[model samples]
Target: MNEIAVGAHAPDFTLTTDSGDVLSLAACRGRKLVLYFYPKAGTSGCTVEAHDFNRLKADFDAAETRVVGISPDPDKALAKFRLKQGLTFDLAGDETHAMLEAYGVWGEKSMYGHKYMGVERTTVLIDRDGKIARIWPKVKVAGHADEVLAAAQAL
Candidate 1:
């Protein structure tokens, strides 16, 4: 996978949202974006991360930044997860892992001494011009939304 870097143009993608509607990165031009990738829909870490972003959705909006979460889960699972968690922001379904791989977040991972291919928890901050402003790879959930919000506000 090609690693993305700051100042590089972000890879554009179109994916299905939890709402069953299509969302494209190209549509976000002229607006900053917080594109976060998670491994699974209903897992604990993923849930906490999603909720943190949800809690800060208004702040992101105020900063003129749109926050979207993506995972390999299907639209049905994504929708159910959103409904269960009451998340108002977009949660995209990347069932093909195409977006994940494009962002270099899909690769080898290890848990309990076992290795497998999976999506890495990552957050990419795209500037209004669609260039990568910052990337949080292997993100930790605690206080993470605040950090991303700070970056977005700075942009």
Candidate 2:
């Protein structure tokens, strides 16, 4: 697992968004960015996380930050989730899991005695200078967006 540390320069990446566009670390330069990684799309937990981020859209915007979600799902699934949830931010599919691995969110996971590889529900806050400002590993969905917003605002 490629673990990233806060204060380290964020590894740059470009991912294809649900809208057929793209979200790149370089594009978000000079502004804060929140990149949340989830195991799957359209699941209950993932939906709640997306909604939390969506609900705080205005607050995030006011904080001069951009929020983007990353997952291993295909673009089709991501598009559906974004539309169904009416999410204002971008959702990018990392089917290749390259970016996910670079951020160290993809790793061994198990449920009901079955071990497999998947995303670890991580969120990374990248500051304007492209350094990692904060990282939430094994994130709990409740109040997560609010917490991230507060951090972004502080930056």
Candidate 3:
């Protein structure tokens, strides 16, 4: 599949969320959606990002936006992470990395001179019509959720 690009249709997906509920992107159509891809649950960067987004949940709700996080972690791990972090948003379990690939966030990564495959932190803002509003590739954790919320509010 061609890489998802700005102004293109956001790819639809269905994944089991931390709450054991199956969430489909199609079901979220007609609402602004924040699809954030992270490497894992409970990690420092991921936790900070999720916590920030969670803290601003009301802001996003006021703007009529929905936030969904994606990671390769299993449902059990996601549940623990959510509970540990007090995150109120949905954390989708992308065990197969299928949705990650669809969003082009899963690929080769390197750290400490060791190359391996992992998720490249990214955030995609989908508009009401399920179109890509903005794509933040290789995102920096700090202040990212705020930026995304600003874009969603603008939308």
Candidate 4:
């Protein structure tokens, strides 16, 4: 799959959310969507990212933007992570990697001299018309949510 570019249509998907509800990108039309992809649940980087997003949920809501996290973890794992982290936003499960592939975040990664197939820390901001507004690829955990918030606000 090709990486989604700004001004292109965001690939829509329907996935089971951590709250046991079906979440589709198309369903979130008419609002800015912050779709973030992380490597795994409960990991140090993932946790900090989730927490940061959680902390800014109110601000995002005020900006009329919706935030959703995506990873290959199952719903059960997402539930535990959400509860443990006190996350207020939705976490969607992408166990089949369809969404990840569509967004072009699932790819080769290396850690500690070992290579593996995993999610690249990435975030996509979709405009109200469902077009990709901005993309943050190879994201650093620090101050990421704030950056996303600024982008969403600008859109």
Candidate 5:
């Protein structure tokens, strides 16, 4: 898969959010977006990452950016995770992995020397023009939301 580069037009997608509303990238065309992909829902790292983004959601809104998280988890799991974590942002289901492939964040991963295919922790900052502004691949959860918020504010 070719990695999406900065300044490239973000691929458009429509996925079901935890709220049961369909969210389309085209609908966010004129707004800055913080589209993040995580490996799973309700896990430690994923939980922290979602909470971090949720905690700073107001700041993101102030910066004119909308944050959305995507995972390969089913919509039910996404809904439960969002409710349990008190996340205010959208948690979208990508069970088909189409969005994952389009964003090039799903690939080989290793844990304890065992290889597996999964969604990499990635955050892509899309400018209001709908172009990729920044990409954070293999993201570290701690302080990552702040970093992405800073980038969004810069945009």
Candidate 6:
């Protein structure tokens, strides 16, 4: 079960990004952070979600917010996906799933009759103080960025 909740202090983590740079939860402090978790990158749904976030990046920036996408993909795969999609924001790799578990996005998932462990599609909106302001669980890709942008703008 996802333990993270609104009004709670978001779990801290350090991850490797597609650009071979390090990103830490602490680094996002003092800024509105939109931390999004996806099952995988380059897949249809994930790609759409990434593109949607990338598309609204300017708006997010205007709202003084930063977006970070995290998945269990390795750094090399994340690099390829980031390059392929022309994503400007940080795409982090969680190969160990430690950060994903700390954020409660990693768990067992079932698809069609088969069960497997994977990342759940979720988004946590963090306030400038690093507390969770909102959360979107089991996200629907279509128009998701608009919804997130509205919330971020409100914050």
TM-score of each: 0.98, 0.98, 0.97, 0.97, 0.97, 0.97
lDDT of 3 by residue, 6-68 (tens): 999998899999998989879998899999999999889999999999999999999999999
Candidate 3 at residue 116, lDDT?
A: 94
Mark the 10 consecutive residues where model 3 has the least summed lDDT.
1-10
Q: What tens-digit string does per-residue lDDT give for candidate 2 at 1-155? A: 99999999999999999999978999999999999999899899999999999999999999999999999999999999899889989999998889999999999999999999999999999999999999999999999989999999999
Q: Count the backbone clashes (under 3 Å) in each candidate.
A: 0, 0, 0, 0, 0, 0
In model 5, what is the error at residue 25, expressed in angstroms?
0.9
Query: Number of the top candidate by TM-score?
Result: 2
lDDT of each: 0.93, 0.94, 0.91, 0.94, 0.93, 0.93
Model 1 misplaced regions, further than 4 Å:
none
Candidate 5 has a TM-score of 0.97
- How many clashing residue pairs, candidate 2? 0
Query: Is 1 or 6 the stronger prediction by lDDT?
Result: 1
Error of 6 at 132 (Å): 0.4
Model 4, residue 81: distance off in Å is 0.5
Give candidate 5's root-mean-square deviation (CA, Å).
0.8
lDDT of 6 by residue, 17-53 (tens): 8998889979888889999999998899999999999
Q: Looking at model 5, report the run of 10 residues with the lowest lDDT sum.
A: 1-10
lDDT of 3 at 55: 92
Off by over 4 Å in 3: none
In model 6, which regions exceed 4 Å deviation?
A: none
Question: Which ten contiguous residues of candidate 2 have the minimum total lDDT?
Answer: 79-88
Q: Would you give me the overall lDDT of model 1?
A: 0.93
